[model samples]
Target: MRVMVALIATSATYLVMQVLRDEPEIALEMGGTYEDMLLQSTAHFSPLIPGHIWFRVPKTDARLRFIDTQYGFITPAARFFTVSFNDNVITNIRMSPQIEPLLLDDVLKVVLDLQDQWRANGWTVMYPRDNPPFADTPEWRAKLRDVNKGGITFWQAGDKYQVFLDMGRFRDSKRPNEERYLITLALAKPWLPTQVE
Candidate 1:
């Protein structure tokens, strides 16, 4: 039984590797519609963990529909993902190592690995001390303000992509007095829809 499970995992990994190798632009492209996003994610990820499915959550806001999943793995490897789309385009994606205890070092390692992936793909990854790479607009200012408050320690800017890594701890509302750490890697398209404002 153990051998069978290992075989399945290996076969799935190989299939995913083949897909990624065939599609160099597997990194979710900016401006892709929600359907496009879903198709791409399903095609790229469903093989990693059998039986896991991607689905949309009920719409809380008219402009955005939250799509979430617990797939087996992704580059830099994450299990949980929440994606937000507005006006048919993906506005945000948040990924985390959902198997928790959410240690600081573990989260940082994932963030760094993801940064390396972006760097390899031509993005200019930046640390917080560096000058912000985004255009200084009201929208960006507001966005950065939120990022700053959220503990953004790493970021990057590309022609169309903006990525940020946030790491912080907060008191868990459900378990009073207990601290919980959140490590989120977020991706957004630079020219986001005004509906997000």
Candidate 2:
């Protein structure tokens, strides 16, 4: 009975690892990608509704948050959803929530579900191995490495889409704890003109 239970446990762990290792397939399309859906939402809805659209932190205040000038809207600060645009083009989309402790399996499941949804909607999703660097400090790098080991997926559609799971230390004056877990699903189009740094 002990051996049988061990086998089952091992099998389940292996199955999850395999699922995480496999790359999501991609399909090419001219228009109507996830990017388009976000742009449409931003144009049609109001940011006042937390889920409908992401609010832009005006340029004056955005600099204070260390947000790039090109980015009109800041990444969701709490458990909220938002999409960002650059020159009328969809640039970023994010869904983030605060959790007590970051769970790798939970984060992976969320990213996979999002990938499946976009694929179902006729978007080509590619899980790329390379991710743009974001960490600077040794401590930050160590934390990021730990997260990456649990399996991080960087899904992209050409140069226009980027979907990934990431976490960071939240800095909000109202929130008591600045450190929180974040799961980000971001999209970007490199061709669009951006503000000079």
lDDT tens digits by residue: candidate 2, 144-197: 446343234444443444446565433345554533335654445433232211
Top TM-score model: 1
* lDDT to native, each model: 0.47, 0.39
- For model 1, residues 97-151, the per-residue Cα lDDT tens digits are 3435344445445555655555555556454344233333565434433523434
Error of 2 at 94 (Å): 3.3
Candidate number of the best lDDT? 1
TM-score of each predicted structure versus truth: 0.48, 0.35
